[model samples]
Target: MKTIEIKCDGCGADITSTGNCFDYRLALVVETRAVQGPSVTAMAVSLPLDHDHHLCGINCLDQWRDRKRHEAKLWSDWNQQWKEEHATKDPSGRILAWQSPPREILDARRPEFEAAALAAFPMKVTK
Candidate 1:
């Protein structure tokens, strides 16, 4: 639960917050199902995100929380879909590591909408 000011790698826009998950594929693990048989299993990952934290006006804190929630939901959905679509008969692969949003020097986000976002995730300053 770390929040910090960072630039977004994708759009170069200052994002107020971000959520990351470090997912990996297991070694020699195969998942099977009636619908999708012989699927590869991926392991959970702990990714770090450096989101923005600011108090520009009234009730800004609450808004930030909402925003963070949205981010979390987005990540969760993406991961679930990815696992089903990209499973490899087994997690038995070289294990490719990748970041969704990547990294940035500064995060860009609107003051209005951004406030609600920060509230979504808990804050922990690693730096």
Candidate 2:
């Protein structure tokens, strides 16, 4: 039989033979650019990508999963609040105007997202 070594993505703990290792994959798409005026277009500038995480045990996996779930919930709440507060309707009550969260708000969450992704892997600094 071929032997393989599995290491925890969070703490870098060896999990080979433990049968407790959990593997998770995150599929993500990043928008690179937006164009306005004339054509007025947004494009999917990134190819599909997948991030894989292996956890040594349930605790690590649970932590990672919980963090992601919390972020998703927060985003959902924010979207709902924004829609309720800013949506505008015409005389016919047809929705006419709405806006997404400001760029600053979206930018602010970027680091948090990056941190969460990084937490699933060993940290290394390259010069």
Candidate 3:
């Protein structure tokens, strides 16, 4: 079987997805507060199909499917750890700490990501 060659989206750097594909098949989990309480969810994972690194887009669905259970278990385990680490005296013992990211993370990072968006919408918005 022939190996797949992927490239970086920004620098066009080549990425080799050979025997260590699992290493790249990572799941990014984001923690947040919900009506039920705290919740952890998958953000993205690597796709099994070949993709050019020159176009590495984050797809939480594709990446987490392979390890959905593992990711859930990880979140459960992490929740337990968080509780233990931040046990309070009041007794409610709830983390009550996780918060959503500020718009600044997107605002600051939007500039970096705008390149891709602009590329996709070329000729529509010229600067």
Worst window of 10 by summed lDDT in candidate 1: 22-31
Per-residue accuracy of model 2 over 31-125 as CA lDDT, tens digit each: 44655568754366444434556664566666555656665666677677777788897888667889887899888976775565555433332
TM-score of 3: 0.23
lDDT (Cα, tens digit) per residue for candidate 1, span 1-127: 9876543322223345434954221112233434566675547833343433344222334444455567666556656555555554436653255334323311332333344444444343312
CA error at residue 69 for candidate 2, angstroms: 0.6
The regions of model 2 sitting more than 4 angstroms off are 1-50, 90-96, 110-127
Enumerate residue pairs that collide in model 2.
Answer: none
Estimated TM-score for each candidate: 0.32, 0.41, 0.23
lDDT of each: 0.42, 0.59, 0.42
**Which RMSD values do the candidates have, in order?**
18.6, 11.8, 17.0
Q: Write the per-residue lDDT of candidate 3 for residues 1-127, one digit (tens) a residue.
A: 9876654333333434536455453223343435464775556954544442222334433322323344345446655665666555345755555444457653565454444433433321110
Q: Highest lDDT: give the candidate number.
A: 2
Q: By descending TM-score, how would the candidates be arranged? A: 2, 1, 3
**Model 1 residue 43 distance off true place after TM-score fit, in angstroms:** 19
Colliding residue pairs in candidate 3: 7-53, 7-54, 44-60, 45-63
Q: Is candidate 2 or candidate 3 better by TM-score?
A: 2
Give the Cα-based TM-score of candidate 1 against the true structure. 0.32
Give model 2's TM-score versus the native structure. 0.41
